[model samples]
Target: MVDQQTPVGANAPTRSGGAPALRERLTRRKPVEKLVAETQGAEGAGLRRHMGFWQLAMIGIGATLGTGIFVVLGEAVPVAGPAVVLAFVLAGVTALFSALAYAEMAGMIPASGSAYSYSYATMGEFMAWVCGWCLMLTYGVSVAAVGVGWGQYINELLHLTTGLSMPAAMLAGPLEGGLINVPAAIVVLLSMFALLVGVRESSRVNAVMVAIKIAILVMFVAIAVTAVQDGNFAPFMPMGMAGVSAAGATLFFSYIGFDSASTASEEAKNPQRDLPRAIMFSMILVTALYCLVAFTAVGALNWADFADGETSLAGILTAVTGTTVWAVIFAAGAVLALASVVLVVLYSQTRILYAMSRDGLIPKAFSTLDAKGTPRANTIITSVLIALLAALIPLGPLADATAIGTLFAFALVNVAVLVLRRSRPDLKRAFRMPGAPVTPVLGVLSCAYLMFSMALSVWVAFLAWLAVGLVIYFSYSMRRSALEHEDTVEVRS
Candidate 1:
């Protein structure tokens, strides 16, 4: 029932005639109007639209709330001191602009691929490939980073529950003085299994994990409240505005998964209405939670105490209560919570690749879904590669790459919003970014600022990756793209 005209093979009427045809196709953007039609008309299509507002919001919350606070706090707090509280607010505001752009686009497109699909529809095949490549790096590297974080928590939980721990050699990748992160790889494989079973099943599991994680954080706030000291918050902005901005740049990782709701647009029961609500609600909820935790943690202990990346939050609880019980509970919650993060991040990765595949930008095998409407082959392939990275790579470098890649994609979504508004003013939008061009313009500027704050080494690595993507685009994707052929035919006729 997916408007047969918009099916995967619909655009493959015939190959473009020659070089002119190919060039035209490559540069020709899929009209936003047509793509919107395909999505609106494809209801009884393959993918099930079973997700409601609550389920969709949980997907965003479950993915966004995990590693950022539990792990990255250690790294960010020391940079900004107690002003890290303002850092969270700054990062959330920056993320809010992009999130508004995403909401508007989601209402109009209502498809997978998040920014990539929006770009393909409004920008062109070439730009679409670029967005897809950025997304692949963002989600792919994020999975590895989350997995490694989970490994640290696993070690903490093990040492707490039983008086035994994995040897340091078995606990981290070689870059971190360990043989391999075996626990990280194990968790990725487990998430892969859950996804393969079904989306609804995975959704349920993600919701439950989110509930438990919120409960754990709530417990921390309650206990940490009793121990709050006025002196701890004195001299809050010790590092000044520059440090606050830098910490905000780093803490941007915590806000990455708020767009998970947008990715599920294709699976929403009433995407136009529910998708926007889900995205907006999730963003507000997450921003509030992040601020509360930041304020409470800093109030309960000196910012200097959070310098250790692995055990900062748990250590704070232990120091405050004079008991190991709270720390143990926190560690156990981290272990479970980061697992759900893996599941959702990996899920986003596969779905983006699947959308690109369906568009003929990648191999169809990557997009081919089973009877249950899950991308089984795609999930397995992504899991294998991610597991290897988690097992072999260091967390610091992987985290840097993910953040930069995501910022690049966020900038483009804002651009897409600007483009679509001009090209399709009549397009019905369930939600619109307030202040129009100003909001998206600010989104682009803010994302670029954060990207500039990244280490020079990260910029070098991101450029090298983009260089490789161009080669793939020119050599392979150029000739095989149906968008090219479809556009060429329209122009010729």
Candidate 2:
């Protein structure tokens, strides 16, 4: 039989000679200095660094704007009543802290994995594994939820435009009294094909889609503001502080996609400079849009009038305009916009898995690039998994689970920024968080608090998923990790 060892680098040490003990292997961290050097070396880093600040910012906006304003507002408004506007502001503050931390890390690492790469370089391998596992779950589930939102908008648009609509049995998952969500599955497949083609193509398409959605939102706000009733402002705090806080926790999901820009660090032309700008610019821009939409929508009608998951925004437009025309246009815009959300979320998932595979945490096949420099295997695997989930699962509970998983990752990123600053003060950073330890501390605390706001079942689901990740890490990844092999060789040599 051909020796499997022959294909490995001749210098790589084997277990027979001696490898890192299991405990050490799991705890060892990647040096920040080494990570920077490897990135600079340009050794077989297959992705093309073609994105500019504008492209990166557009990607962030595309990823962030769609899911929250278009779908989430319906659920959030009912919880916080008219005070949901304040909830958007609250959520934006939490997002800003995490975004600032991400900016510093992206400027320092400028690689594909986002928080996972940052944690690996600053913290230990085990922390990195946990962060990567959380992100994998968050992005995967978020994409599925976005797909369902797109499906809902498509149905609304069709009923308005052609007097035709999908059957209820075919419009949702079995958990929602339907067999499957066909439109959700369709959007996932469409986005998958776009990714397989290339990042440049997908990103360009996403930018155009983002512009259209923004215009649609601007139009909605303008019309809704005109119809605002003064009495809608009087009892705005009907649900009080507890409701607003809970709503803020839910709205935080809208900001989840801001890190999607950081995940493209390898693909940015000037990652050290452009990534920080993209991260900050996208968060500020999306936050402004969310607050405007929330303020206008609630003012136009009482908060109690907003229905959960019933095409809330479009219904408001139709009711106010005394016609379905504006609603049709709004629904069409949502379909276009949410498709971009799915694309960006799926893109982030494939890249994160690719980074992990390159480290030998999963399998190298996932990191193998096609001629276009894309990890086609990883993309295909992610596409299939997300598509199945979007088709078979209900959206509401899935969204809550996504929130907790993402919060866990955000907290880790905040910690990574703090740890790296202390460990390697000499490393050059293109951007720094304003308050250093203070900002990062708040980032950690806010994320922890929001995570606690989730339902007990959501916490249960997140813990169960983490349990699975630990089993895989110990059984398969601990044996194959490339870092352990490299360390073993250096010690033996």
- Residue 317, model 1, lDDT: 87
The lDDT for every candidate, in the order shown, is 0.83, 0.85
- TM-score against native, each model: 0.93, 0.94
Q: Which residue runs does candidate 2 get wrong by more than 4 Å?
A: 1-17, 40-45, 307-311, 488-493
Clashing pairs in 1: 25-484
Give candidate 1's error at residue 466 in angstroms.
0.9
Candidate 2, residue 391: CA error in Å?
0.3
Model 1: per-residue lDDT, tens digit, 1-493?
A: 1112222223533344433444445545666566556555554455678999999899888879888888888889888999999999988988999999999998888887789988887666788899999999988888898998898888877877797988988778888877889988999999999999999999999999999898999888899888888899878888898888888888888888888887787778888888888888989988988898888999998887766654468878889999889999998888889999999989889988888887777898887778887888999999999999999998778878888888899999999998878766888888999998999999999999888887889899999999999999988887677664453322212
Q: What does candidate 2's lDDT look like per residue over 202-319, in tens digits?
A: 9999999999999999999988888898888768788899888888888888888999998898888899999999999999989988898889888887777775445478888987
Model 1 CA deviation exceeding 4 Å by range: 1-17, 21-23, 37-45, 487-493
How many backbone collisions does model 1 have? 1
What TM-score does model 1 achieve against the real structure? 0.93
